[model samples]
Target: MTETRRSEIPPTTDPRPDQQSPAASFPSADGLRFRPLAAADVEAWLELVVRIAAFEKAPWHAQRSELEAAFSDAVNPVAENSVAGVDADGGLRAFGRVVKNPGGDKAYVLGGVDPAWQRHGVGSAVLAWQEARAAERFAADGQPGARARNYVEEDNPALRALLAGAGYSVVRYFSEMLRPLVDVTAVPVPAGISIVPWTAELSEAVRLAHNEAFADHWGSEPRTAEQWAVQMTHEHLRLDLSTVAIDEAGGDVAGYQLATVDPDVEARHGRREGYTELLGVRRAWRGRGIAPAILTDAMVRFAAAGLDHAALDVDTENPSGALGLYERMGYRAQRRSMAWDKPL
Candidate 1:
């Protein structure tokens, strides 16, 4: 089937077990067959993800609903750019997709492999496929200096070696920080600024503030309206636990913290943790303590909602000095994910 037509069919919620297998319908290398991913492959894709996460001792963050939505996103077109590897039993072993950035300046190469399949050529083959696809997409857009980026957990030796062998180099590091909510103190808002609960009406303003705030950040780009809306209305979003700081004098957004609660995490860990998905202070508001104040407000709100902890991810080299601020605010780095880039 053609790439554009592959994702036309709706996904199957319940993919059949591998025990009842179907004959290979695609090409093979190293005894593994490959095919373009379809919307119907979401279930199998998730199964492979769960297996990989279990072996890695981490929780899988992408939900089934999110993957399904992504497969159906007309703009992103992940299903069109993705490929999956299947083992002899017709079970999914690895999957990868290269997604072009909003402005078509770059593309993100994201993928996962079943633990048993790692180091067995599955990852290498998928990486090659993703890079080729990334180059094709970038060339189509006439983007120059096209770079393919991917993130791997800091401790994954096999995957790290695979990427390094493929000429990918470490370009960035991201830390996952966690802070206990017990006895947390909320900072008083600075004079002439107010912290207000986030509302749908403020999404666009907040999006603009986010773009402006992160403009100087490395590898950052202004999000398109569709990307911003998807993030704000994401399934895991907890609007009540989120807050935005407003400049009382001009009534414009000064800073904001958007939070989310993962039901899968709560169910698995028996504890709730509020995630600060986006936290930013506009350029004019920086150095005035707006970011910290809004973050403190988010922590207080999370605590009030009975959440035991709050979490956020930060780039180690953030131009805004966010790492030190988070540390001083009682957050500790729990783990890290490292970004790798390969020029195509």
Candidate 2:
């Protein structure tokens, strides 16, 4: 649930997009000074994310390429949407980004602090700064009721405490699932449906079908063309390995399994992982077994590519019984991530 969203903060002279003045930098209780993250800081920022992940024993890992893409205009357009805390030693201790979800109904604040700096007000300052930016963006749109959300690992008590003390309430839970690709069995495509390799020409139809499929899911929103383009052009998107289920009768995208191969996953985990990033079946195609067929096809493709495993994230409370379906398809829970939110 630590996914990036497009922020809508307006352009400004202030280094801190949410703050009234450029000089009003975020100051920590210690000597750390917060500043807007720059293009040059991508590597160090990714290192901080990896550090926190290891400290928290998170099953999923971060990649510099992914982080770089997220900070670009295609994802988070607001330059000041992200903040970083640097120590006198020239090390980044904490970071935060206020990303506006596609539909603008909610803004997600995603960040983590060095364990050593957790109780010294670093986390609090980063969270407050993110909230300020989100509030400013919401007010600019004249939507005072917009919500700001934060997702944290269930085992991270410090983060949970900071969020609760800041007035955020638990809203949902998500599970990170992983499945070994060895001996993956493929499921047959349903009648009147065909599984095809993802193509640039069919990207729009696939994107629209995905949004329609998840329209009823919690916090779901239709993806803007800009957002959809980001995924289609993603650095690690494996177009050949991705599966698109098309309804032959109507020539519409009925279901899809968009997979990715992170260059850093093997380097960090000692094994290659093919991530099933998005798996959805349109409402008209639900209960037709299209989802599982598409998902299993992706796994089979991963195995054929010599990958060690497949990974995906799912909301545990999905009304479509998605969690049960994934488990039945051989995916097992690897870790838990939680989502919390408060109105802006």
Candidate 3:
């Protein structure tokens, strides 16, 4: 999905303390010039994301605070991050950003162009420049391979065409599924199934379990305890809104469903949505209905908190057939977004 304020979970820049992304082509284009984005560009950049999402028929709920957080070291022009464009008539008409590249002998592309400003040699120039920058950065560190790779949604014909025409091919596919809070309940816990809140005392355990669950995910990255603390301790967080399923006797995280109600989301969507952002069941715990059970708990909690709905994304073709699960629970298809990439 396109990076929205709600889905700003950026790819990890470096998986470990010793890893890094490569610099690229920075290959100069004919007319379009490359430049780093300024702080003032944050507002405009976010607006662009919203407009593009709408253009794709998936309008996301983003907040001003989230936008401001985007232009920082975490999201800005680090070796792993990029912002490039040209000023026509003293104003920006085109823009694109590249996320962290998976550093190796091969290179990766975590970037995209505004559809409205496509063609006219703009995208090519920008991409060429990125390749140059990637190569340059790698040279500074004296590394090899670092080839660039990117993933495109199978259903996004437009992006598929653009990347293919530009030398990119579909490599992998994922599904976006949802879980409706319809007929939610605090179902009776099976003998070993225990509901646990991510309280201050359980933070470390919860974080460890989350990391383990996502370890096999494509492009997974390691996160430090401090980083987990930073997010869980957000000033606006409502701890009561989250639930982590545990194996009480085994002391392991089996399934989890973290919920949130962004003020911006509620205001924009005109409904109190108890958004289920992260819902997962460990690989070994699958098929026992652990995931649906956690989701149901979230929906019921949200309903009790005055929420109108609960939503989440699942890879369309997940072995789990997550889409069928949500559909059975009353969640509807809302929108879709795509990604495009080419090797350097």
Q: Highest lDDT, which number?
A: 2
- For residue 159, model 3's alpha carbon misses the true position, in angstroms, by 3.7
Candidates ranked, most accurate by lDDT first? 2, 1, 3
lDDT of each: 0.73, 0.74, 0.57
List CA RMSD, all candidates: 7.9, 4.4, 4.9
TM-score of candidate 1 on Cα atoms, chains taken together: 0.86
Q: 152, model 3: CA deviation in Å?
A: 5.5
- Model 2: worst 10 consecutive residues (lDDT sum): 2-11
State the lDDT of candidate 2 residue by residue for 145-181, as single tens digits.
8788877788878778999999999988888788888
- The lDDT, on a scale of 0 to 1, for candidate 3 is 0.57
After superposing candidate 3 on the true structure, give the runs of residues whose Cα lies further than 4 Å from its correct spot.
Answer: 1-32, 61-80, 86-90, 101-116, 132-158, 178-180, 226-239, 262-272, 283-288, 320-341
lDDT of 3 by residue, 98-174 (tens): 54433334344444455566566666666665666556545544776444454554555655665677776554444
Q: Quick one: best TM-score, which candidate?
A: 1
lDDT of 3 at 181: 52
For model 1, residues 100-201, the per-residue Cα lDDT tens digits are: 653455677778888876667777777877777777666666677878887778887877898899999998888888888876876878999999989989
Report backbone clashes per prediction. 0, 0, 35
